[model samples]
Target: MNQHLRRLAFACTLFYTAAFASASQEKAKAPDAPAATRSRTLVIEPFMRVTNSSPTVVELQIALRKFTAPGGKGPAVWLSAVSHIGETNYYGALQKHLDAQALVLFEGVQARASTNAPAPEAARGAPTKEPAATQPAAPAKAAAPPDKSAKQTSIQHTLAESLGLVFQLEAIDYKRATFRNSDLSIQELQKIMEGDPDDPADASPAKKNEQLDRLVKVMDGSSFVGKMFAGVIQIIGTSPRLQGLTRLALIETLGQIRGDITQMNGLPPDMQTLMKVLIVERNRAVMKDLKSELEKAEPAKSISIFYGAGHMEDFERRLRRELKLEPGETLWLPAFSVDLQKAGLSKFETEMIRGMVKKQMEVILP
Candidate 1:
C-alpha cells in the first residue's frame, strides 16, 4: 500500500504539472489572416523555465515577452505568460507591470448560464461572432467570472494553499478598466468540446463528455488520483520539509517539458482533443480581439495579453504569422523557489528526489 501511494503521488505530480503547464482558457473564432504554415522550427523563446541556483535550490520562472510590427511601427504588444499560482510578490510585481499598459487582453472563461435559456449577447457584453472588418471596436465586457466551471472547486486555489503560494485570480486584480475579456464563453467551449453534430469527423458527444468528466474530476479533486494527490498535498502542507521536496519535484518536471509541444503526445486521445479546444480554439478568440483593438483609430500604445504560460507558444505563432509582429525584449520573473537546505534536505536525498522525478517523467512523456 505504501509503495502504491508513492507511485500514485509521483504520477499525480507529473500529470498535474503537465496539465497546468499546458492549460489556459480560450474561444472558437477563426483568424483574420491565413493560417501560418506549420514548421519544424520554433519562432519564439521559451516562456517558462526552471533554473537551479545550486544543488540545494531551484526556481520556476515565467517570461513577459514583447513584440512589435515591422520597424516597431505599431503598438508594443506584450505576452505575459503566467503561472496560475505563485509567490505573492511575483503576482504583485506582475500586476504593477501590467497596470501601466493601456489595454490588457486577459484570459478567463465566462460562467455558464444556470438554465437552458440563451444568455443575451449584451449581458455577456462581448462580440459573440467574429468582429466585422469595418467594425472599429469590439464591445467591452466585464472581467470573466472567477472560476471556469461552477461545479468544480478552484483547483488552482487549493494547490496554491498547499504549496504556500497565492492563486493568480486572487493575487492579480482583473477588475481594472484596462483589462478585457478575451477568452471563450463556457457555453462556446462546451459546444466545441461536444463536437459539431453536422461534422461527422468530430467525436461522439457521449465520448467527449466521458473524457470531459474524467478531466473535471481530476481537476476538481474528485477522482481517485485527485483524492490521493490532495491527501498527499495536505500531508505535505503540514511539514515544511515535504512541501519543499514536492516543490522541487514539480520544478524539475515542469522544466523538462517547458515549451515542448510534443508533451501532449502522452495524453489520451479524448483529453488531447479537449486540450485543443482549451488552447488552440481559445487562442483564436484572443487574435480576434487583438485585431479589433489594432483596428481602432487610437489603439493603446502598449497592450498586454495576460494569460497562462501554456498559451504563450500558440500566441507567439499567431502574433508572428497573422499579425506580422516581431519578438523583442524578454523579462523573466520568478514564480516559485525552494531552498532544499532550509527544508532539511541533504545532497543525497535531493539527488534521490531528482532521480525519481526524472524516471517518472520519462515514463509519462514520449
Candidate 2:
C-alpha cells in the first residue's frame, strides 16, 4: 500500500509539470498586444507635402475615417502643416475648431517597447536560485520588420522617403554647436551665415540670407526681442538644453515664418513682435497647447491629431498617462500601397524604389 501511494504521488507531479509547460509554450506564441485599446480618440490628419501633385494625404485620411467609422468613433480632424505654416495675423483660424484630449505629435521613433526591461532586476523579484537542468532551447529573438513587397505605398510614405533624405542631411550638418553668450549678436549671426561657418553646411536647414531679411520685415514694429528670437530659431532650432528634436518641427516652424514674413513687409515693430512671440517661442506654448488638449475630455465628436512624432510622448506618456491606453486602441494606420501599373515609373525609377525597399519586405526571422 505504501509503495502504491508513492507511485501515485510521483505520477501526479509529472502531470502537473506537463500542464504548466504546455501553457507557457502557448503564451510564447501569442502576439504582442497593442498599447492602446479602443479608447475614444480624435486624430487630426495633416499632409505636409505641397498641393496639386498628389492628394495622397487627403485620400488616406478619408480612407482612415471610413475604416474607423464602423467601429463607431468620431469624425477625423483636418489640418495641414503646409497650409497652416503662416499666420499673417493673430493665431485664430483653426483655434475655433480645436478641442480634444491632446494633439499628440509623432517623431516617428518608437522602437523601444519595454520600459521595464531597463529597471533593476532585484526590484522585480528576479530568480536567483539554481534550478534543475532542462533541455536547452534557442533564445527567442525580435520579430522581423514587415516584409519588402509590403513596402509602405502611401503618399505619407513617399513624403517620408523624400523627407528622410532631407532629415539625414540636416542632422549631419546642424547638430548642436556651442555658442557663447557673447556670440548672440546680429553681426555674429550674419557672419556665421556669410562665413559659411559650418563646413559643408550645405545640409543646414536655413534658407538663403534673403529669407532672414524677410523675417525681419515681418516683425517690423515688434520688440527687438522678437527679432532676436526669430533670428535665433533660424540659426539654431532650439536651445541646446532641449536637444534631440526631430528637425521637421523646426523646419515647419521656420517655414511658416519664412513664408509669412514676406507678407509682413513694412509692418510696425509691435506687429512683428507678435509674430516673434507666436512663431519662435516653442516649448511653453507647445506644452500649454498639449496640456489643454489632454485635459479636454474626448467628446462624441473627437478625432486624432498627427503632429511631430516627438509630441506623442508628451501626450501618451506625460499627459494621458493615467488613461493607459491599451495597445489595440491606439491605431497605427497601415501605410497604403501603390499599384505598380498605376505608378507610371520609368524602369530605372521602379528599380531604384525596389532596391530602396528590398529591406522593407524581407523579414529576418531568428
Best by lDDT: 1
Write candidate 2's Cα lDDT for 54-88 as tens digits.
Answer: 43111111111111233434333221111211221
User: Alpha carbon lDDT of residue 232, candidate 1?
Assistant: 61
Q: So what's the TM-score on candidate 2?
A: 0.23
Query: Model 2: residues >4 Å from true position, as ranges?
Result: 1-287, 293-303, 306-315, 319-328, 332-337, 346-349, 354-366
Please give, for residues 1-366, the per-residue lDDT of candidate 1 as tens digits.
Answer: 434434544554665675574455221222454344444355567777888777767899889999999898979999988888889999998999898997888776633233422343432324222335634474433344445343235555666787798878778876666766666665666777776443236478777666656665666677886676666666656667666767777777766653444344567555656665566566766787888889989988999988888678778877877787999999999999899889876777667767998776677654
lDDT of 1 at 343: 80
| Alpha-carbon deviation at 316 in model 2, angstroms | 3.4
Return the clash pairs for model 1, or none: 26-184, 26-282, 27-282
CA shift of 268, model 2, Å: 33
